[model samples]
Target: MPVTQSDIALAHHLADAAGAVIRGYFRQPAGLEIKEDRSPVTLADREAEAAMRRLIEAERSGDGIVGEEYGTKDGVTNRRWVLDPIDGTHSFTAGRAIFGTLIALVEDGWPVLGVIDQPVQRERWIGVAGRPTTFNGTPVRTRACPQLEGAVMATTSPHYFGEDAALRYLALTAATSGGHNRMTPIYGGDCYNYGLLASGQIDLVCESGLKLHDFAALVPVAEGAGGRMCDWNGDPLTTDSDGHVLAIGDPARVDDVLEALHRVHD
Candidate 1:
């Protein structure tokens, strides 16, 4: 189904509101607390999520919501909004610009609308399933880098991998001739990187430690851009997986990286 302009407008408004909530707390002296998951949580994160939740509830009354800060609200609507109000709480607390907001509208478990808003970068990427992806209102497409040797990859954090896993990842990088591996600690940037993948700016993105809110929106954005997103084993990502994601510009490159990852694991 084609996405409506109303959906886009609602997503944009939601992102803008969330960004304002996050920016209001930026650079202000505030206390940080740890959640039970050991992830850092700040007032900005909770407030932003709350603001987004409120806007979504008001605008899309029949739609369901799954948010990072708040738990799920079971509804009968086939359309649900998956939100990560502050994608990079760690980076935000550290005064970094890699954090952003992730929002996706899923219809019947398939993402029909995806939006990634990078407030610090002042950029937004939107994708509608079976439609062209866009960056700031302009259409975007992924590059044609099918070989691992020519692909550049990015990840949220290197410390996410233990010593053995890190070594294996490094080996995969080496096999790819070490093409511009960046470790940007941006939790929400995963979706942003998928936008870049669609725009041909980045070739690959691999990361773990994610949730359904983290990967669901990215699936359509990446695939809609002529790219592919999957788990490390080259399997479809589900809400119940281990939260590891591997996205690449070309299918061949994705396969190559997955093979290397499998070899390392072996």
Candidate 2:
């Protein structure tokens, strides 16, 4: 079903509520703890998610919820809200403004709307399937990169790619590099990178080990901006996809980049 105006309004409300809760705890040393996975969690992450959940339960009681800090709350309706209260928690704790709240609506196992809200920067990106992406209320579109050689790219970090996967990324990077049109990959900025890509500030973003909440919000943002997002195997991303993901602002270069990455995996 097409996302309605009511759905879009609800998405903005959720982001506003989450942003309110997050701004209260941002960079204030509000009792940080390391999760079992070795990633840091803070009061901001928990409280922001709780605030959003409260709004969701109150406004759309029938919709399910999946979140990072908190567990899932299943509802009878096939529609679900996926939340990453603070996507770049590490950056958030380190006093950086790159962290943002990610929200996605997955209906019948497919994402239909997404929002990337950076409370600190007061910038937000809203994406709805089949609609033009908006950044701070202005329509935005992605820039074209005809080839890999001159394309500008970004990732959170190479370390997150892991040892074995790092080699695969390195090979892909080498393929984009040449004497004059060398591709210098920018590091860091998590969810913000996808928002920038949608705004045409970036061309490619490749990352691995992402979860449903991690990359689900990204799909709509990229696709709405006239780009494409898929798993490294060139499959459409869904709740069932493997963690490997790729985002290219230019559709023409997707096959070439995907084939290059596939070579490393093969």
Top TM-score hit:
2
Q: How accurate locally is residue 74 in candidate 2, as Cα lDDT from 0 to 100? A: 93
How does residue 234 of candidate 1 score in lDDT? 81
Best by lDDT: 2
Candidate 2, 14-122: lDDT as tens digits: 8999888888887787789999999899988999999999999999999999999998999999899999999999899988999899999998888899999999889
lDDT of 1 by residue, 1-266 (tens): 46789988999999899888777787776468999989888888888889888988888888899998898987677888999887777777888777778898887776678887888778888878788888888888888885787467787778787776677677677666654545322233546677778788888887877788988878777887888888877887656567778888887677688888877666
Taking all chains together, each candidate's TM-score versus the true structure is 0.88, 0.96
Candidate 1: where are CA atoms >4 Å away? 162-168, 178-191
Predicted candidate 2, C-alpha RMSD:
1.6
State the lDDT at 178 in candidate 2: 47
